[model samples]
Target: MQRLTQLITCLLGTLLFGAAAAADAILPKPFTATYEVTYRGMRAGQITFKLTRDDATGRYTYETTADPSFLARIVISNAAVERSVMEIGPNGVRPLEWSLDDGKPGTARDGQLQFDWNKKLVTGVIEGEKIELPLEPGLQDRLSIQIDVVTSLLRGEEPGLIPLIDDNRVKRYSYVKKETTSIDTKLGKLDAIVYESTRQGSSRQSRFWLVPDREYLAARAEQIRKGKVETVMVLQSVQ
Candidate 1:
């Protein structure tokens, strides 16, 4: 009977460890990253993105702000802010709410989104119209997609087809893994896995280089629109 008791205890221990490990896979390591944004090889602005998590409650908030630089700052009013608050769980990251401000006055482009998990629905205001749509399981928003991608890469898993809710439309995005490479940044040389995604029905493409050592944070990103580089951001610092 003692031997049987010992065997049961061992099995329980193993099961508990497995559960904890799985949960850790999705729990984000809180960090803030600032990237230098450039447009068509000319300095346009800077983007600062931050992530924070509460381990006890499994809640997280991700926010990003874009600020113009130099001449662009004087000529353009293109500042913007985006944020998402969600819950991280064993199943995946569930977006509780999201908001966007385009910095345009007297325009209806600013809106908010709310996710109803129990009803499997999303309600948001878009262009001054309130709409409701069915939400899919494992659905992610534009801001949350970054977290989803990083988490999947950290776990050595494919991001698959991510369903994104943005601009009053539900669009599906596909991520293709390219080759692993190293990126030279202000911080230093770092190894990363590259991923590319093309905009559906457009010539725009975006590439992300995520460094594994830094918890799969994107070290650099490039956005090309219509055969011209629209923006490029290299990791400037992290905290």
Candidate 2:
């Protein structure tokens, strides 16, 4: 059979060139994330992001949880840099690498997280340097951490580069609205786009509930600030 049609056309051209060189790392595979943030009313704390994606180098592994006994008082608990993030690229977030809780070893105060994809804005750096956050113009009604929708959920179009693992420290924002959305539970539903300055603002409507033919993004909905009260988060399983 012509050598099985040239070995099935070389396995379909090596799976379409590995899915176009991984179209930016293809959503980081394995999923299971839940975040419920609120303001102006109270319940302003809840985070759970457990990720894993390493299908032969797509590379990614996260673990963030909240309410570790609410950590003491005034509601400013470090939660150890949101349980020490580490997303290397697809945007960038390198917050901590060691000593947490008491903070100190590298002192990453847990602040400043500037993102601005495409146009390339990239912020947040500790120990190695660069950190100056303090910008708000459209979003951010004092979100403790969800920084404009969590790096628009690990974007990818250029070899998966969106990992900001904190460095240098102390940045109090200056501007952010570069698009961010997520509602994925092992590809069930809810998927919005945009992540870093798509010209400028106005495009933050989200709704999710996938699975019709899924692979990721579980449940999502965001909007309604100012007076607060609009929020939707679902996705209770992923591995």
Candidate 3:
């Protein structure tokens, strides 16, 4: 049960967002989306994602909530929440803060991080331990990384290797374009561009099916481990 809960939480962490448009390209948009989550071919739960913007400050708050289903509730009792606060600029999305609450308060899985771009550092607490790391160019948090990738795609640019702060360490993920395909969703059948992302030195890979006509929204996503699909999230609705 503990292992299953952990896998579900990991799937929730990988879910992406549907973004808005900027002056010349699509940027992060304030919207709400829902996805039906499945784990190991079984219905697991649902994930709700929201992105809100402070128009005056131009800062965006992206959040996601994972609610386990009735069957899954036996093992996963609480909903996990992840949030990232960031801004979009000429370069790309810059994450200012990131946090995760695994639904259990006071547990080691809960953490918060603050990014100080001026100081060129990221300071935070994870697993009840303090951490500080030097910032790198184009650094992003877990949630913001997807937005950055989508932004690059919207601009007709390839999102090669992206460096993001994951938990206590900075990890790099390589994004590669895959063949274009069509998928059936609640909204109807739509064409999508597939992109695969793999973390360095890991066998786990995630694939995203994004619909370009709909502002590059992710229509479906799957997390694969050892070449076998472990979790899947399909778009239910978007607004």
Candidate 4:
């Protein structure tokens, strides 16, 4: 009788776990956060990130705009807009579309990727070049990946290997938790968890600090390439 009781208990536990996972897959509340961008420790630009959800369709849209500061504009002279549309299911994020607009002051280069989950195909173009790749589960775009990382962390799950779509290519990146410490931001000093990105065979490295109380939002990010700091983004405001 004891063995039978143990078996029933295990089955109940599994069912409950599955239910909880499905409920939390909807994602956090809608929010907007602005970050001050810096390059080599100087003011450069600003990036505003926004996330919205559709209750009826259970879809999400994530958008970010990076604009160079007036002074910095003279040096860089370009801005970027990135966006991603996806849905979070019982498994993870299922990206539907990803796009970016990057170019000079007036002329812009447009790149977009469309995911057809039903057909299991990914089609897109990057810099006017045709692209086609296999569609895989758990795939995320550059922008959506950041959201998934924070969501997984808040759920007490390890942010392990992540499949991300970038430049019309699919790449799996591994993230390592560095440490949990306090960092000063425009808002104030706050405790944060830091994570470092490992991109195989790439010289560029990136890091992010996530604030727990704020739904595990990314408070700051730094990108370095070839031992030189390329850009930095720090939390400015949240709404």
Judging by lDDT against the true structure, name the best candidate.
3
Residues forming the 10-long window of minimal summed lDDT in candidate 3: 9-18
TM-score of each: 0.83, 0.23, 0.90, 0.81
lDDT of 3 by residue, 136-234 (tens): 989988788767887787777888998977667888888888889999989899998888888778888888888888877778888899999998889
**Cα-based lDDT at residue 38, candidate 3:** 89
* 1-239: candidate 2 lDDT, tens digit per residue: 12211111111100000111236433334444554543323443554555554567644445444432242224434343332233344333332222123223435343334444333333554333554443322212112123223333333122122221223322222222334454445444344432221111323232333221233233433333233434334344443
lDDT of 1 by residue, 1-239 (tens): 12211111111100000012545765676766677766667886766677877768778888776566776555334565667899866566789998866666754666789999999999988668786999898788767777776566656778777787866778776778899999888878989878777547856667778766666667777766677666677777777
Order the candidates by lDDT, highest first.
3, 1, 4, 2
The local distance difference test score of model 4 is 0.66
Clashes of 1: 0
Candidate 2, overall lDDT?
0.32
Instruction: Say which candidate scores most in TM-score.
Output: 3
Each prediction's Cα RMSD? 13.5, 20.6, 2.5, 12.8
Instruction: Judge candidate 3 at residue 70 and give its lDDT.
Output: 88
